[model samples]
Target: MPWEGISGLVNLMGTWMTEDDPPVALHDEKAYVATPDRRLVFDSTSQKTLETIRPEGGQPVSTLKRGDRNNAAPPVVTDGSSPLLLAPFVVRQAGTGTQASRTVAELVAADAKTGKVSWRLRLDVADWTKEVTDSLAISDVGASANVAVVTLVKKGSETFSNPSTTYAVDLTTRRVLWTQETFKASVVAGGVVAGTKRKAASDEYSTPTGYDLTTGAERWHDAAEYFNTYLRPAGPDLFYLDARDRAGGKNRLRLVDVRTGQTRQDGVALASRCRYDGVGAVVCWGRDEVTGIDAQTGAPLWRLPDEKAGRVAPRVSSVWHGRVYGKTSNDCIRPRPGVTSWRTGIPSEIDLDQPWSLECRRQGKGRALAAAAGSASPGRR
Candidate 1:
């Protein structure tokens, strides 16, 4: 198809029939260019299938492969990663030249004109027809566009121990820099840091661990009662993670530096997520109201006072910037009107230099509790 519709309404689209290769991604206003047959790219605009593209006379790229080895979950895009990553599959054939089952991961990257194969790292399958369980993860290091951390997990047979491994792959070299056991991981601050939960005791408090991207070493470990690694675009110091210590009913906001691993009181007690409106300026969303604060000292900046404060939750909440934006509960999926704003406050309103001023009131409550924005994140393996 050719360019049609409005002046600025041009879109490129394609699909591949083969399997086990990277896909292609078209630059803006480019032609129906194909990637090398050995490559494929995931078109988020088009569904989840990997579409194949061949650059005129280049090799054929396979798209839309399966990863049904041992009933593991299918590959889904992580927060930040180039091209795209897919889980391996075990293909089973029923007839001539027809694939019935397979296990492979498809990585797709873009190039100058026609996208080329950065690499096609196949899943290490032991048998041809035996069942397999595998999982894959990809993380984009915000600093460099050419490097990505890829991880894969494979389960052993019923009689063998569980088998899994994580590989930090270089997209430019198509080489594995390091490999280790699969650790439950989360990407924070645009993939600058990998947040993993490390609980030393079942009955004791939980802690958060931050690993360096370059060396894969633990840079900082939070052992406090309510400390966790969170990623928000506040500064160049990896991210500003919120931590709070709960005594009776009060939870204070403790801002932690991802680089130095030091904690400071930001005084902006948010029930959920908050963002910096400006330098050292914080806009916190609460269950009932939204408050701005000083980004550096964590002092109240301003309060977008709630009109009907009694109906909303006491905790802070947020709505990320995307195609749409609205307030929702910290854990709720649906956005409601009464939900508090996560990033509505500014640092110029409050006096971190002084103390937060608020007129307290209480009424018949149902689920109102004090929870800060920097609460600990559970589920770290």
Candidate 2:
């Protein structure tokens, strides 16, 4: 899709194709279809309130005519039931944008029927010196909800060079509940566990810390440097992989507990990624190997014989419906003898139930060659 701005008729016509409608395209969850009576709404971190657009009689609406700015990605419309919250702000260096650019956070809420903005909230968080990565956290606690966590970044403006802070905001109030300055920590993968459901976040800071859902208060914390990549949490033990910095590179693998702040895991280099498979299965991939670790005690369950699993070095993306999805890069957990290439291909989702079989399959003619070559073939070839 075009990154930003409007596309003319020619471009629109050329780009138009029969694809599934985006699940979110409406202000209200009940208004799913594109109807003249209903309005379309957009909410962003920059635009804190929601914006609405509606039809003017039989013609197009004025707001609809306006191009989508602020949001680099097309504003994904959703049935209001579940809104696809987007990145809040463009984390540019401070002093770059004019005073007008000083505006830090913006939010819009729109009228469901007329597509007019019901409310708009904008604020200035001052000039940021360091480049801010787009990472927003939204959550609901009790009766109130929060929209932006930008304040947390602003609070630690002096430490902008580090750019590692765990921020939690109550969307209902558009207020920051807590901002924890982490050393190298972040909100864990999967997302911050508030009540029951999972929430999308900007960064996965390592330190496991809690903040008051209402008032910004530190409730609990865990050192991130002590662990590798923060995997999802288990009961009392949090599952994660740790990387061992070596001469030229590092090796990563999984660890259990280690909350005492010690940085050691039985000499197992931190896996590139580690995730909970089901109740017991903890899937982990290191240099040239993917193994299922015991979720309860962090023991090695079964190692996938694929020697390239480490080479694939897929970041454990997600564990859903019994499958593990990951994206691999050149910073492989284990690099092969002569391969230094980086690729982000869809690796097979390892299925925990079928522990004996490779869950992901190769595609096209490559699959045949892979089957014929067995484990001897190089993946990059």
Number of the predicted model whose lDDT against the real structure is largest? 1
- lDDT per residue, candidate 1, 1-381, as tens digits? 211101122112211111111121133322221211222333335433243332222111232223311121212222242433322222222333664444444344333233343345433423311334223222222323444454433332211123333345555576555543423233333223444333421212224455665556666766554423233434334334444342333344545565555665545455345544323455545455555555555555456544554333333322222101221232221222232333342111111221111211111122212222211111111
Q: Which ten residues in a row have the lowest lDDT in candidate 1?
A: 372-381
Candidate 2 wrong stretches, greater than 4 Å: 1-86, 91-103, 107-161, 164-166, 181-185, 188-214, 221-269, 275-281, 294-299, 306-319, 324-381
* lDDT values for all models: 0.34, 0.32
* lDDT per residue (tens digit) for residues 1-381 in model 2: 122222221133222121111212223322222211222333322332233343221221111123321211112221234333322322222453453222244333343443444444443332232334243211111122323333223222121223333344444565555554432232221223221111212232233344444454444444332222333332223445443323324444435452332222444433555544334555655566556555555555455444565433334433422444433432211111212111212243221221111222221111110111011100000
Q: How does residue 207 of candidate 2 score in lDDT?
A: 39
Cα RMSD for candidate 2?
Answer: 13.9
lDDT of 1 at 34: 24
